[model samples]
Target chain A: MTTTLGRPGTRPSAARLGLYRAAIELKTFFRERDAVVFTFALPAVILALLGAIFDGVYPGSDVTSAEYLAPSMIAAGIASTTFVNLGTGIATDRDDGTLRRLRGAPMPPSAYVIGKILMALVVTVGETLLLLGIAVVAFDVRLPTDPARWFTFGWVFLLGTTACALAGIAASSLAGSARSAGAVMHLPYLVLAFVSGVFFTPVGALPGPLITLGSLFPLKWMAQGFRSVFLPDSILPQEVVPSWEHGRIALVLAAWCIGGMLLCLTTFRWHGRRGR
Target chain B: MTDTPAVRVRGLRKTYGDTLAVDGVDLDVAAGEVVALLGPNGAGKTSTIEILEGHRDRDAGEVRVLGHDPARAGLDWRTGIGIVTQDGADLTELTVREAVRHFARYYPEPRDPDDAIELVGLTGKADARVRTLSGGQRRRLDVAIGVVGRPRLLFLDEPTTGFDPQARRQFWALIRRLAADEGCTILLSTHYLEEAEALADRVAVIVDGRIVAAGTPATLGGRATARTLVRWADGRQETDDPAALVASLTRRYGGVVPGLTISRPSLEDVYLDLIGDPS
Candidate 1:
């Protein structure tokens, strides 16, 4: 006997579904005026304010304080787009029944994940350009012309964003509601910014214990990697170590990529905590 | 198999910590039949529907939907089902058309998004942001998304809970069309007796996590054989044959039978009795 229901047809490929999901995600993200402004502008505004307040060059280097901050702020900006935005955005989806609707559909879980990460990537790229424009215009920070430097910048951006995006997906489960997601995401992000020297110059100036703690996380390494691409080598002495520590940076960020995926697999929930 | 039921459950049970949401329960919905799971709040209606929709796990049960166990069902099984949940997602940032079109992509064969909007009577508001829609319009949008996939079996969980009287009637018409024209099987859960009476080919009354009664609207809880009351201006009596009694009363009253009326136990009365709700 044969069933009359459910016609036989090939499902849309996962890649095609992922692209569709990404389109919807991007459309939703950009349409929310307040979220768009907050996510894209907050880091740039902070960089501008810090650039204006700190007027002098760092000791023994031609780099002004504003120039010193440009690269670090880019790293922080990436964190904002991937980690903070994704964490809160996912929590809001849970509170509003988005996950329930998605779960009910025939779409694959991987497609959803791909959509979110791609949305973050597109937003982060725009955000990076915005910051780059501001740094060039307001802070006299030069854009690197060397192909090798850009090559370094490319890898760091991809790996750092992936790691942070995964971590954000894992962290989203901690928020009890959409309303509380802001606090849940921001508290850790602000602390990481301070400890990772996104707010301060010269990582060596921070307390040794703080440096050690920061080194264990991806944010500190991301900032160092960005600094190596944009800032002069003469400014390297101010780092916790005299060199860029490129090998360790890669290892730490890559490890975070792996560790974050594990955490997400263990902790991610499609439904809100209150849901059955 | 052609004779296989679209949905089947045996000894289904679920618990949330200390509270039992669904006790030992059995149900079956055959292909092309529209069944309503009628129950009040906390009656395990949502839990049972969610389990069948593959959105929740049951503590213990044998369940199958569309020839596959929902607990382990794949995407193909999901493609056969449409669900209109109690509360829908707030897709506030998306326009109504965009939301419908996006969901349509999830299915292998889907109705045109514009056609779905038209079917739900939201064609006028297709381009409006979802946040701008009124409560009833949003529910209509939910229905559009639910049906866009052209599902073979549909689950509507209190689809008209917050709808006004007119909106409820309109929704009922849409549901009737789907069942009659498309031959779609439906299992809808609602606490509204009137809704169940209006839409269900079969109604199952659930109380305290168990089905207490199940039958056609007229025969549920022995309603068909139940006595009817015949009343006149001066007197009333319950009898098996209301027509005969009314004739006798008309003769005794010399033709008109002043203020004569005859009534049987209504579906509401049988339902109230089944649920043991005195009010």
Candidate 2:
């Protein structure tokens, strides 16, 4: 029997509860050694490698390939960790009964959703910063000085991160177990990175069909946004536009973000397959 | 309202594909009562409990838990109910104390995390990660999480399935405390007849989604009034009163009857009979 008398219980506001859960999730994210390396270290390593092979200026462009690939890789890393990682993690929780427990608790379902989004965003932002640091040091890529470009990059980052995160959440329903979740989420992530021109870009010289196909994805828009910031004005002729395609990129990424969120809200499976 | 029971069910029904999981069963548990739902596997115990816990949608019939229809109840209503599911969910990389503390935040009136852990006799391993705990220990953790909310109504689905005898006894004691001290109403399902007799104020036997018998353990299926058997070295008699039969047998032997035994049917016997033969 409990010997110490407890104080009268107090109910935490829903928002407070959500932030608390998010805090714990963030802590767990860092503590899980594999996840930390996968989300944070793996991208930096890949970026460094990409920076090595393609760091020099492109034949038709003034900017080194690192300046171009930096943002694309950043987008790819965010997509992999936030979208794919969250997908598998959610699936594992479902398979293992965490979702069931949460469902039964007094906490709101939104609290769980909020916890995951916050976790994804926190890591996405952190990983982006780390990738930026590497781009600066290893590849000598410089941060954009123009306030206008920074503003554009900010919204592009937000839209792209959330779009991928929502897509991952939506895709989790397709997975029956954690093992299957990896393959289910990985396919689209890899496909998007490749088709979006995140890799092998200087897209002007690429096949017109490929560039058109890549333009449809948010990853491509995110990459273009970064290029606009890092590449000089002289590189405009080979770009998607003379400077930044801020309006078009924002429009596409935002549309994807809204569509993905709606899909997740409608189709997301909160419980495990066992219930069926 | 004080008159309302902790749980009330009327014509509860559920189905999985073509099979009925819970039939038109009616049950009621008064406030502060410990009611054990006893049945074999696939007997609809889990399905019924899940519906009552509001985790599953019932196909038909009316059900109320903690005075609200669980099917439509909101978080305010859920604040008073606790469930320790059949399978414990493993929270990766969190210590016992941390997990308990984390779940405690989800309730309106939660017990102190440390106190809840101690109540489950897990103080020794408070800091141990949940994955490292033994099966029994993790089960204890599950119970701790369930009770930390200080729920007015607690649902335990085969709570002691993996427990050793000592742990089972300890669990029974903890549940007794929850009932006796906090007036928490408990609805649990169990396979062990002893667990039913030791903890439940009443036992309800279910078979094939129907309650075949329900009463206090001694009186379940009229077990208390059932005939007793008196046996001696070479003779046996089924009678209402075994003491009189034993006395006559002693007199026939002009002393203590050799190999004398007065026995009545065990709860398990009546249970098997009610549910049909187990073998």
Best candidate (score: lDDT): 1
lDDT of 2 by residue, B133-227 (tens): 87778888988998898887899999989788888887888889888987888999987889999999999998899988999998999988999
User: DockQ (Cα-based) per candidate?
Assistant: 0.63, 0.42
lDDT of each residue in B1-279, candidate 1, tens digit only: 647899989999999999999998899999899999999999999999999999999999899898888889888888889989988757999999999999999998999999999988999999999999987888889888988998878999889998889988998998898899878899999999999999999999988899999999989999999998888899989999888888788788788988888888889888888899879
The CAPRI class of candidate 1 is medium
* Whole-model lDDT per candidate: 0.90, 0.83
At residue A57, what lDDT does model 1 achieve? Answer: 74
Residue B125 displacement in candidate 2 (angstroms): 1.6
Error of 1 at B158 (Å): 0.9
lDDT of 1 at A10: 73
The TM-score that candidate 2 achieves is: 0.94
Q: Which ten residues in a row have the lowest lDDT in candidate 2 chain A?
A: A1-10
